[model samples]
Each structure stands twice: as C-alpha cells, then as structure tokens.
Target: MKKQRPPGLIAIVAYKAFVASLLTVTSIALLFALKNHKILENFSESYLLETKLKIIELLLDKFLIVKPKTLLFSGLAAGFYAGLTAVEALGLWYQKGWATILVLVLVGISIPPEIYELFQGLTLLKLAVFIANLAVLWYLLHHLPKHGKAD
Candidate 1:
C-alpha cells in the first residue's frame, strides 16, 4: 500500500505549483507585451485616458520605458524560474530526496536576499513571502529525518 502524503508536504507542493503557474503566465504576458509593444502602448494610453487612474498611470509610466532587451531577458528568466519551480513541485510530489535538498538549498539561499529587500523597503507582500519561505524551510528540516527513514 502507498503511504499518504503529509498535509504540510502537500501544501508545499501546492504552493510551488501555484507559483510556477503564476510565473508561467507572467512569462507569457511579458513575451506577448514585448512582441506587441506599440499596440500595448497605445492601449495603455487610451485606457489611462479613459480611466484616469493614478495607479494605472504610475505603472504604465514605468512599464513604457522598459527596453526590448530587458523585456526579452525578463520573459526568459521568468520562464526558466517557472520550469524550475514546476520540477520542484513534481519532485516533491514523488517524494524524491534530491528535490528536498534542492528546495532546501534554494530556499536557504533566498533568505538573505529577502532580508535585504525587507530592510531596503518593507512591504506586506515581501513580509508574507519571507515568512512563507521560513515556514517551508522549517517544515522540511523538521521532517527530513523521518522522511529519510521511510525510504
């Protein structure tokens, strides 16, 4: 008989999968935006004029200045990250030992940068991400030994 996966592990897998899905969408959007830059710019301008929303104006202002090379790089990078995250999710779902280590190392390395970002400018989104990563790290560390014994 197969063992049931722990709820925490399931949650982690779900989280990774969700992140991968979001990144994939973002990657596609960026690439599309890059290809249709002029159309996007015209649409944004008309949308801004119609809505007159400060937030949209602010965001579009910054977005308009992005170079094509930067867009290409950002899209490619996001795609790569999405692929990596999907692999992590699948590996964890199958309870692969190397996946655990991969996650541990990736999450561990991110902590310092997260801290730096928080210190640079604290935000609710950043705080939540930092806490979530910490929780994942703690859960894996706590459960690793038991997980190994099961193998």
Candidate 2:
C-alpha cells in the first residue's frame, strides 16, 4: 500500500479494506452459486436431497433456491456495487479532497436508511452500522476542508 497521511489514514484504509472485502466475498459467492448449481440440481432428485433437506431444515427455517441464474444475477449486482465502492475507496485512500466530500455525501445519504432500519428493529448489526456511518459522517465533516478552504 502507498503511504498515506495522518488524521484519517486509518479510517481511509479501513474503508478500502471494507470495499476490498466486499469484492472478495461477492466474487466467492458468485463462484459458489454457479458451481453448486449442478450438484444441487442432481441432489434435488436423489435420496441425498431428503437427508440434506432434513438437516438444513433443522439448522435454518429459511428457504433458499440455488438456481445458477439467480446466483449469477445476485453476484453481478453485488459486484457492481462493490466496484463503485472500490473506486470511492481508492479516491478516499489517496486523500483526494473531492473524495472526502463524495464519501461524506454518500454516508450522509445512507444514514437515513440506516435510521429507518434501526427503527424497524434495534438489532446489534443495525446499530453498529448506523453508528459506524455516523462516525464516518462526523469524521468527514470535522476533517474535510470547508468552503473556500479547499485548494
């Protein structure tokens, strides 16, 4: 990684890592979705399906369809968002002034939805995400250059 200035270096790196992680996870999910399709299709018509379904039902009550097309679409959608995140992360990491504002604006936009989700259910994950976004928003506002200060 290239050298980064202090102040928000850690935050910027964390953001970059977060985006990179999403890229890796989504990429792997895409592969898993596509590769497991055949095995799932074969097992669906075999005795293995009965045993697997029993075990799965016991573990989780959720229903899942392992169709390649659906998986492909999901992966593509995730990858698309991940790509955008990557670009923003790169910009932020480099400390481009514009990137900070861009990220600030984006995070500010996301806060409303996060607040809504928190309202829907006060889960730990939702709270953490909201707080994290709030922190990012605060950090950006506090650190980013204001008005004509940008040069």
Candidate 3:
C-alpha cells in the first residue's frame, strides 16, 4: 500500500466545491424568483407576456430560445464537480494522488474559457477569478508530493 500524503489537495477541492455549490444555489434561486413573478402569472395576457409565453410554448422553442439544454448541462456539470470534490474531500482527504490529479484536470479544462473572456474585455472580477484559478491550479500541482501515481 502506498503511504498517503497530507490533506492539502482535498482542501483545495473542498474550496472549489464550495464555490460551485454557491453558484448552483444562486441559479436555482434565480429560477424560482423568475417563476414566481406576477408578470409571468398569465403568460398570454400581454404582448410581453405573450412573447414570454411563446418562448416557453414548445420544447423546441424553449430549447432554442432559453437554451435549456445548456442550462441543464451546466447544472449537471456543477453536480459532477460537487460530487468529485466531495469524494476527494471526504474519502481521500489526505490522499494526495487522485485528488491532486483531478484538480489539475479540472483547472486545465476551465482556463481556456477564462483566457478567451480576457481577450474580449478585461473586467476586474473576471481577471481576479482567472488569476485566482491559475494560482490554485499552480499551488495544487506544485505542492503535491511526488509519487509514481503523478507520473
């Protein structure tokens, strides 16, 4: 059996999961708020409401207009992230190998979009997040103990 490493990697995974969970909760809250608005009570009553109603009228219309598929995919991805994070945090909290590798993979996949956004119009918040993400990625990849597993 391989000796386990310290808890640093899982700690980072937990932090990332915490952020994703916050986003999930925020999105659900926004959906609920939109659904409960009185302006949406009778979706066919006014022109604006009718437009909204038409947008939601059919599966294809809703799929294309509201991009529910994208939302669904995002929700699923968030859930997956949370699940992976929890597994790493709780099960192998002190096991550096798997958790560290997973974090690196996640960061690798996420950085491209941040870079693309940076080229369009740089905002402080976006730049801050991108930098923070890069920092976290660097910290995890660099601090993880060298073992056969990492190769």
Q: Candidate 1 residues 20-137, lDDT tens each?
A: 9999999999999899988768877784457677777777778889988899999999999999999989988988888898899999999999999999999999999999999999
Which model scores highest in lDDT? 1
Order the candidates by TM-score, highest first — what do you get? 1, 2, 3
TM-score of each: 0.88, 0.72, 0.58
Worst 10 residues of 3 by lDDT: 59-68
Error of 2 at 25 (Å): 0.9
When 2 and 3 are scored with TM-score, the better candidate is: 2
Candidate 3 lDDT at 71 equals 56
lDDT of 3: 0.62
Q: What order do candidates take by lDDT, descending?
A: 1, 2, 3
Q: Write the per-residue lDDT of candidate 3 for residues 23-89, one digit (tens) a residue.
A: 6675574455344444343443455644565545553334334444555566566556656656545
Backbone clashes for every candidate come to 0, 0, 0
What is the TM-score of candidate 1?
0.88
Give, for candidate 2, the lowest lDDT window spanning 10 residues: 57-66
Q: Local error of candidate 2 at 71, Å?
A: 3.3
